[model samples]
Target: MTLVIGLVVHRSHHRLFQEAARTLTGVRLEWVDYEAEDEIRARTAGLLDRQRLDGLLLGPVPYARCRDLLPPDLPVTVTRSAGLDLALAWCRALARGWPATPVSIDTFDQETVDEVAAALDLDRERIACLPFDPDQPVAEIVEFHRRFLDRFGGRYVISVRTGVVAAFAGAVPVLSGLAGLGTIRAELHELALRSQSKRASERRFAAGVFLIAKPERSANLDRARIGLMNMLLNTPEYADGWIEDRGRRGVIVFAHQALFEAVTHNWVSLPVLAQAQDTLGVRVVAGFGVGPSARTCVALAERAANRAEQDDSPGAYLIEESGVMIGPMGPAGHPLHFTYRAHGAGIERLAERVGLSPATLSRLAAVERGLDGQAVSPSDLAGSLGITDPSGRRLIRKLSESGLVIPEGSAQVNRKGRPSRLYRLGIGAALAAGATAPAGPGDAAGGDGGRDGDGPVDGGRRDG
Candidate 1:
């Protein structure tokens, strides 16, 4: 039987190690709160001197510091991030079974070299650290990742930011540094211990909240719609809040169905529910999708969240798979299906045309593809009308005056903030509804107008 010793540098980590120590038949977990560098190496040596001890496990920090004192004669294992020769050496020691517990410390610096060095300690020159700068941006990070993959022939990165993820594709699988089904629980032990000693650490948590409801009356619809809008905008106005709310720019509050309900029939307000870490607060960005199916509706809302965060129009933020303001309005009560059929073809057309919001393109594509006028909410018409986020109402007013789209019903004015406008289809809607032939010669057709213009996709303009 082997005797294992776990050198816990922090007392708070005891419970975790005690449980893990049970996995090894003869392993014994112990602690030494090393406040100094010498203490770290001394404690490690003391454990190594124990003849019955078969292996050693070192804490991340202390193991990293006193790596030289760790014995080649003992089986050693260290706790740390990947990419270190010192770690591999300690692991090798443990794999072979040792005279004492193996101690190792892991550090971010020269991890690749450290791991390679331990594995090929016999040939120092051949063990080298690969090129990398921790502060590189997304593009540079991607390049670094590619180089790493090429160097190792088969390797994966532990963590990556959102930007580079789309570029890496299948070249590698993304893995978080944290692992284990009960890892959160285990990490909590370390965190609590560190906290007791007054250590500073960033918060690690996220949360989501969803508000659901149907409008019963125009007043209820007004309150509920404004309520939702106020909720989304609330976050940016405050230092901290439940939601990292998006969709504040092109918010959809009172709309056709909502107006009808408020003015005519009554509807129920759905409850709001959320889930997240106790430490982390929740943030929300409301999304609205118009469709016959619940699936499409939810999809629209999800898109709303995306657009809001990116500072985009809610219409462009979601998915629509039905009739368009620019195209033929689907039969009432069946907008979802019409949108679905027209959405893809519209997107392709949009790539060629440019300037139109996804909503505007959607509406225009619908019209060009079909015969009758499709549904054109103020928001949909605004998208089809190519109104920038700040101009949702102005575009609606312009289209209404131009005779492109029409409001489904009356809308309340918000004098305290931006004035709320109603939807009305007119000539603008017709132009959107009609499959516009490529504009003759040079009418500024698909010209450099708004974001994602002839301008760069990643740089200025598009970010908004």
Candidate 2:
């Protein structure tokens, strides 16, 4: 298949890019000419709806002017003046017997201007510089150069813009901008590769649902839907290809996998979901599913949505293709956001004694809830805390020192290495009396607190 790349250029540079396109193979270059910023934006928008263009290459001026109007997912290349191009421009000035000092520049950014000044060893204070801004009116730009010429007494103008060149037509000598055809070719090649990659990634199907968990009696569902629309539309990545079902109980969005990755940024956290919930002033449980087929993706998404709705506050969940259930993420504004602190000071004091952060304690406390007052091993705690086993062991040691976890009897398993000992959360009279924890394994003042089992707290390491 031929890779089609669109080029937007001013009329003067039409022959330059057209000639460069002829030297390339395995690609088709589509050229469009524009005289003004608004024209470029309007023409590009129209082209996007009608053309099958893969990527776009625009001059720096056109890019700055028309970028917001283009699709965010589309790969775009903005050509800038660079090394050889700058050298050529400078060589031309020298060939014309132009003086090194008092050269007025109005095209490139500050970095490029500084580089040219340093390369020519010109006096920094004497070189008149103005950074290019495509949005600035032509008259204002003309006046800026007019004042610059008066201030520096410059006899020549150096720029890449045709407008700037026309503005100085009869007043002074104008030099072409630094960037050449070679730079444009290289940038277009890179943009084509990026466009191909994005196109491949978009082939996968993905879907997600946001279920409102019984809205408050006083809340306005209309206002909530408006907030939802605003949030989704403002985030450009998820805005496209979305089919939203704004039902009374939920909002289901079916979109491309690219949007899912953009919304989550491929992270395990729930910041976006929490932000949505807060912005809408409602409890929203979301579930996302990604798969090869839209039907399969929607089914998995429905399962995840059900899991999220079962939770008290808003949650975001994901079901991967490998059948792994990912989350029931916490809503940031929920009243019981921290489950460890939900019961009040006792757990907070216990967390402080064990030298654990409140967030970690909250997660660990959640694991304890599933066990119904049972002990948790380092591996189990690590799994719950999403940390490594070594880190979990370190935490267990700290808790042991704080008299919060007491070692029980050790038991052998399948004649393996040393027997893994049992441990439990010691919150009875011994803890109340402020007794110190055992110094090491087997130094605790008790027998086995409970028998070993395959539960979250028992199968792995010893408590102490």
Candidate 3:
């Protein structure tokens, strides 16, 4: 087995190992900082959803209310002083023989259990002392030995250590753990630079979130990157207007910043990614960049997310037109007076795809004019549906957002001191048109959309 050494981060050990490194042969130096609960969770979740990290190190992080969020199989080592607080967690893993638990204590206070027990009225058998020679150089000192102390079944038997240590790593020998920390130092630095206790609000940029899949993996990691390219370069369903040069690493401001905060706070297991972190797809990492324009943030967030893979490292997947998931998604807000008036709907799959609400849908007949069968811009169509011109622009965006309509081509026309946009339907519209062919005489409903999933069109009667 290759040995990986990670520095301990906790309040138990106050000294730096004054010696050369040992674990770097196969391990990496992980940086862990205490961040707000949500940030930490999102970071870890984002990682775990992709790459597989062999170990995790939560440096000096207090084992507060965040024990359960971590996956049980992965080996974990923490550097916090209050072990007793995590008693329930210990009791849990101990009951099932699950691994991934540990602690680092000081030699001067080997008898910490007695003190900890008295404070909580618990027995000593629940806690055990994992030894590390304090005087030995840093590499020799262990951080999370308490994880192994699952002997003697007793309530509240946990460990406690002293002060912050340099590095604390967690691991899952058979697989990679997407380890992450609540980045505190960097946050403080950014806050300090801005001269505000709270962050100054700014408008976030329009970003895209999508899913992609590849046929193979390459050292160049091109399969996934190219998959991302396929998502951004050609599709005309969503964000077609701004596919510029593959959407470089521009700023991704989010309205879902609040949602990211919510997810990070709620879930554990930080992210461990292994692909597309530095390319045309880089702009989508803003899972928590929330502020004034919150809805936009939500929209962008709905588009991007990280998913974990097994066997090897993790990969990122974008669920756009060319990504893992295809077809149209329900656009937020109402269409005409109908909340479900978003396009990609109509007979056959129409009612079943969208809950029936004829009152709201009848308004679509008023969705402005393309002059008989004349083509009109998506923006104008959405406007006829009551959305502001710019917000209506979302409907005009392409494949990345919805697989319902693909633009045949785009052209610009100048009219009355303003530019008029022109567009022709692509694959999605064509599909719907083909599918909408009138049903035969035996057809029960005038349409043949999604009643197929509900039941057969044949009328079933009582056997009286």
Candidate 4:
């Protein structure tokens, strides 16, 4: 599939970005250029509405302008100028016989500025820095440079912001510190990889098992099973699913994870469960599972179905190969709960050290397993836990402080804001080393042994 990446850029830098991405194959760059920052919102909205974008690439200015308009799940990468860009800007100032020292620099981090200054042996004290703040108005940023210039005489200004250079009206020399082609290309490639990974995840094999509650002796069990199969086959949402009888009392559907996500509304609710109860005049429960293979998926589904059967009402549950379980998903369901099997003493101590429940740690372990060594952003972890993005960020901080997660760079997901920092969850490895031994075979890992209250407060309605 051709990945469509929405490029939200200022008209001035549009050509540069296009050139950087010229060599990319199997990807289409949909340009959304704006003459002014204010035009970003409308243009971005139009692009999103008109095209099915696989990912997004924009500068910090454009991201700040239209962050709220982006979809949560869309892959985004906010391109930033590297230190090389800053050095190049300094070179330009020297070329023009303009003193590079005592200049005010905007957007680049202070560390980056200091590094460049030290490498060039420039006086750090003479340089004024205004770090990037997405919430800071462009006017305020312009005012910062003007104030710094007024207070301490400077040679020229360096800025990554699009309009800042022009805002000066040539009153003071302002050299553009925009990201270099190499940096933009790197971010573009990363965004593409992330988009591809997401697409692949959606296509992973998934299985669902629907079981009818034990009927009266006189009731025809085979007939009810047949009716359930017919109901699933006739449903438009299940068209992609291969439906068949699983046992005398159950039916199973096999399909890609994307099909199940659509049918179950991302596991928030299962209208099919309710529909079956109403249509067949019998209680029905469902278990959906995602795993590496068909057999594993079927096993997980059966376990999830068993869990759903324990509930009093017709409901559904989801179980992933990672050992993450989300359940009781009917109209009467409560807030989503991430339940896991109790790990050994090592996990308990580790959880205590990290200030999280052992169950939460277990769930993190499961999430790490599912990642298969892939790095994830805090938002991604939050989605797995069915929690808010802010909560996810907080959780990451907590884990980071305890050395439970290793920083793995960052990803610019579908926002014009800061890139989401990525990390490799260390909990899985931590468990492997800390765990005394694996759980016994007789021990039911799928049972609701441990319940972590860290799940979404509003149930699993939040997109995962």
Candidate 1 segments whose C-alpha is farther than 4 A from its true place: 35-38, 50-52, 82-464
Scored against the true structure, residue 320 in model 1 reaches a CA lDDT of: 43
* Model 4 lDDT tens row, 135-221: 898899999998888888886789987678778876887899998989988999899999999989998999999999766631888
Which candidate order results from sorting by TM-score in descending order?
4, 2, 1, 3
TM per model? 0.20, 0.48, 0.19, 0.70
Q: What tens digits encode model 1's per-residue C-alpha lDDT throughout 1-464?
A: 11224454544344555565333322234456554444666776665543223345554556655667765534555554444323444344545553112111112446454554456453443222323233344566566566655664533443313334446568654333212214323443443344322211112111122332222322433443334433322211110112222232223331223221211111111112111101112222333444555455556555544543443211122234452211111112211112212222434344344444533333343332321232334543334323454465554554445444565443323224442343323433334454444443332212222223221111111113
lDDT of 2 by residue, 345-376 (tens): 44445656666643344344434433333344
Candidate 3 ranges beyond 4 A from true positions: 1-84, 89-115, 120-392, 395-464
lDDT of each: 0.36, 0.63, 0.31, 0.77
Q: After superposition, how far is residue 228 of candidate 1 from its true place, in Å?
A: 96
- Which TM-score value belongs to model 2? 0.48
- Cα lDDT tens digits for candidate 3, 292-331: 3445433433454333221122222223222333222211
TM-score of candidate 4 on Cα atoms, chains taken together: 0.70
Q: Which stretches of candidate 2 lie over 4 Å from their true place?
A: 23-26, 36-38, 204-464
| Total backbone clashes of candidate 2, pairs 3 or more residues apart or in separate chains | 0
Evaluate candidate 1 by giving its C-alpha RMSD to the native, one decimal: 26.5
